[model samples]
Target chain A: QQQVKQSPQSLIVQKGGISIINCAYENTAFDYFPWYQQFPGKGPALLIAIRPDVSEKKEGRFTISFNKSAKQFSLHIMDSQPGDSATYFCAAVDTGFQKLVFGTGTRLLVSP
Target chain B: DTAVSQTPKYLVTQMGNDKSIKCEQNLGHDTMYWYKQDSKKFLKIMFSYNNKELIINETVPNRFSPKSPDKAHLNLHINSLELGDSAVYFCASSLRGESEAFFGQGTRLTVV
Candidate 1:
């Protein structure tokens, strides 16, 4: 069974528009949620991360809004640009154990 | 310098053959992980090592084995390659168990 589920298998946004991707987890034990961005022929890179204790975390133009009670989290990109086109993955991990469960990826396309 | 490095960016091998993928991390992290991304772009954790000791092993087949000679190096060896094994493998390292991870450029393996 998939521990984490992500929505919108693909997304397209215009430059200066907002881009959003959502994810939900079934396991309540998950405490750490992280987002990864991957380009073609490259490895995934850490974008942003949030802990369950925080309702939201923002860095630069990337923000992660987390709802601990709803077991859901979403990534928001402000002023999306063409360079933001890539695959995004949401992952959950239990601090008690080191295993990380990843959600199905979301491919984002930003057109100028 | 690359924080995490994996050798043999692309490998094409026939069925019943054996191959190895080497991974090394220079981030001074104690935890390392091996992740596989399938054709559908789903990423799954296969193995994890902490301080050169095996910590997590997913339900991967016995044909796949991971060896960690040291905290900085983790290698994967496959025996009897199969078409189903064709995918991109990534190596990652983290300072803490459930923290942000640094990933290496993936190694694409195509089993014929």
Candidate 2:
């Protein structure tokens, strides 16, 4: 199917806390998974990405946890800050068509 | 430099009018795409072009047309816009066979 399901349509976290967003896919053909961060009036920017070969990928304060067996993945933001408040989207891409199937989106808020 | 950019960030037009949105990517990617996000925040791929050639076209009304003169540029044209056409459209690009795709800020189209 062409769906990447995401959870917690909205989330609120205090500064210095941890924020997590989860996503799952039904298609096993997906090879690339990426997370995107978007601020109001801006396009979604690539935060971090991981392939099925690796279990996880970390970039600065953001980390992506991937599970090939469960067909699920998650994004973790360490030391949440107000500036980190934004909408996060998780997407999966199949190798054959290279078409991206995006999740419903999660609005994350980090309060200071 | 902006990897991807779209013109007229906000477009408010009346029904039955025709309008166009232009997109350009400085990333020198060989593939460009158009996606639409509705009120529910579901992002759906509408069109994709590689080397200025149309590769994929999802189910959409005939009123909508996509043109790409080259790999760096892709534009969308709409004729006889309807109320249901109101949505935020995003242009994105990536090098062929790559995972991450750069996205434009998005054009918010409101048809009244």
Candidate 3:
């Protein structure tokens, strides 16, 4: 019940195209959803986040689409670039618990 | 300045050895956490501390223990290292009750 399942373990997209990664959570208690980007040999870093109050949140070229009813969320990258190629992870957190439940990472590759 | 820093970026040890990973956060956050990323790239929360007090502990093995001497520092101590113990460990910090977490440059541990 604590799992956050992510799809497309690996994704390849052309530069200037759109890159999308999907994730679903089982626990309805999760109120906060965050996406993290991790380069090789580096720790995961916060990319964008959204709360149950909002359906979507956009930060620069990164956007997170959330659906509270479906218990699902996705990360969209506009104008995908090679620099954006990395492993992306989706995580859910119940603020009351103060711990994050992370999904299996998605390795994204943007071809030039 | 790095927001979260963990010592010994790479640690290679033999089986049955005991080791420790040190972590410190300069973000003045009241909550700190330790996450382990397995070979499958699944990140799992092992422990969490708020204001130097142990709060969340996942179903990790008893051989793994976490200590927080201060709010800014959280350390992990592992005893009887086994081959399965090899993985990349990350340290993160966040404000209490907030969802945004800052992570460190993970420590890669390889047990032979």
Candidate 4:
């Protein structure tokens, strides 16, 4: 199974709150997991990423929590701001295959 | 400078028409990919090229073909486009064996 399931197709959070999006993958061979943020009329950009070796990775206000055993990962945006309103996608890739599988995007709206 | 750039950001055509989307990456990456995002925001991989060689091809229709003349450029050609072919196509590039991939602004194709 190459699918990566993501929850909450849409999420609304208040500014200064926490925004969380979850994703789970079926392929155990996936060693790299990355989260991408896409704004209106823009391409998906790399927000943050995590590997199986680490349980979590934090970059600025964005953090990725990963669980190798559960084959799941999530993106946490602390102090959610209106500027963060956009579509977020979680992706997985097996370095050997180099095929990046993406989850159905989650549209996040941070209310001001 | 843009890392990954695709041409013709908006393409509108009728069914049975053939079209092409051009992509180029300036990151000197050895791998490039084409992804399709449907109306529901579900992203799927159609093709991937590494070192100007066809590597990963998903279960896409034969009407879709990808050509890479050089490592920095990857182009997608479609034949007999159908109504279902309407989607936003994205071009991405990454270094071999790396988890980070840069994406283009995407080409939105509308087939009527």
Candidate 5:
């Protein structure tokens, strides 16, 4: 079963706009949530991560807003640029487990 | 220097062939993982190792095997490969369970 579910498999955003992708997990035990970005022909790289304890985390133009109660998290890219176009994946893991359950990815295309 | 690296960015082979993808991390992390991404960009974990010991093995096929020579390296061997095995394989490393993971550029394997 897919523990994590992401919506809007594809997204389009204009440069300087805000691009948001949302994810939800069914496993309540999941405590760590992370977002990764992958360009074509490249590996997924960790973009930003957040824990359930905090409601949100901001890293420059990227931010992760996590809602512990809803078991949902969203990544927002502010001032999106063409370079920000990439495939984004969200993953959740239990505290003591080495494996992570990833959501169906979102392909974001930012056009100038 | 690249933190995590994989050999042979592209692998093209025929069915029933046996192949291996090697991964090494210079970050001195104790945990490594192998992930597969499919046509629709669904990222899934296949295996994980910690300190050269198997820790997590998902419901992947028996044809897939993982070997870890040390904490810095984890290699995946796929035997009797089928057309379904054609996908992008990624290698990742983390400090431990539920921590941030660093990924290597994927290996695109096309099975004809």
Candidate 6:
């Protein structure tokens, strides 16, 4: 129940197109969901996040669509660029447990 | 200034050797974490320290140990390293247990 499953282990999108990555969690105790972006040889960095209270959150070109009922969430990158090519990971945090569980990363390649 | 910094970006050692990875955060965050990313890019939490206190241990092997000298520093020491221990280790810090975390450039460990 602690797992956060992510889909499309690899994705290829053209520049100026939309890039989407999906994730689903089984634990309802998770109150916070965050997406992280990691470049080669670099650590994962926070890209955007959302809480269960809201259905969606958007930050500039990055957006997080969440569904509490389905226990699912997704990250959408608008106007995808080659610079956006990297590994994206979805994570859920259970405050009571005081730990964040991560999903298997999705390697996104935004082609030029 | 780097928010989170870890030493020895790359480590190559034999299976029977031991190694240590040092991590420090200038962010003054109360929570810190150690995460391991395998060859398949699967990220898993190894340990967590809050206020310099051990808070989370994810059933990792006894050979793996974490030490937090202070809130600003957390370190991982591996004894009797095995080939399976080869992975990219990341250090991260957060304001608290359920907040956005900042990660350092990972340390890639290769146990041959």
Fnat per model, in the order given? 0.81, 0.79, 0.93, 0.90, 0.88, 0.79
lDDT measured at residue A10 in model 5 versus the true structure, 0 to 100: 97
Deviation (Å) of A33 in candidate 5: 1.0
Best candidate according to DockQ? 3
Task: Write model 4 residue lDDT over A1-112, tens digit each, in one string.
Answer: 8999998899999999999999999988998999999998899998898889999999989999998888999999999999999999999999999989999999999999
- Candidate 3's C-alpha runs over 4 A off are none
Clashing pairs in 6: none
The superposed Cα distance between candidate 3 and the true structure at residue A109, in angstroms, equals: 0.3
Candidate 4 lDDT, B26-73, residue by residue in tens: 999999999999999888999999998999998999999999999999
What is the DockQ for all candidates, taken in turn?
0.77, 0.81, 0.91, 0.90, 0.78, 0.77
Clashing residue pairs, candidate 4? Answer: none
lDDT of 1 by residue, A1-112 (tens): 3489998899999999999999999888888999999999999999999999999999999999999888999999999999999999999987678778899999999999
* TM-score, candidate number 3: 0.98
In model 2, the runs with Cα more than 4 Å from the true position are none
Tens-digit per-residue lDDT, B1-112, candidate 3:
9999999999999999999999999998999999999998889999999998989998999999999999999999999999999999999999988899999999999999
Candidate 1: tens digits of C-alpha lDDT, residues B1-112: 9899999999999999999999999989999999999999999999999999988999999999999999999999999999999999999998865478889999999998
Which runs in model 1 stand beyond 4 Å of their true positions?
none
lDDT string for model 6 (A60-94, tens) is 99999999999999999999999999999999999
- TM-score to true structure, per model: 0.97, 0.97, 0.98, 0.98, 0.96, 0.97
The C-alpha RMSD of each candidate to the native structure, in angstroms, is 1.1, 1.0, 0.8, 0.8, 1.3, 1.0
* Model 4, runs deviating above 4 Å: none
Checking candidate 3 for backbone clashes, the offending pairs are: none
Second chain alone, TM-score for each candidate? 0.97, 0.98, 0.98, 0.98, 0.97, 0.97
For candidate 6, write residues B2-92 as lDDT tens digits: 9999998999999999899999999889899999999999999999999999989998999999999999999999999999999999999
Q: Give per-residue CA lDDT, model 2, range A10-106, as digits (tens).
A: 9999999999999999999899999999898888898899999999899999999999999999999999999999999999987567688899999
Error of 4 at B96 (Å): 1.0
Better of 3 and 6 by lDDT: 3
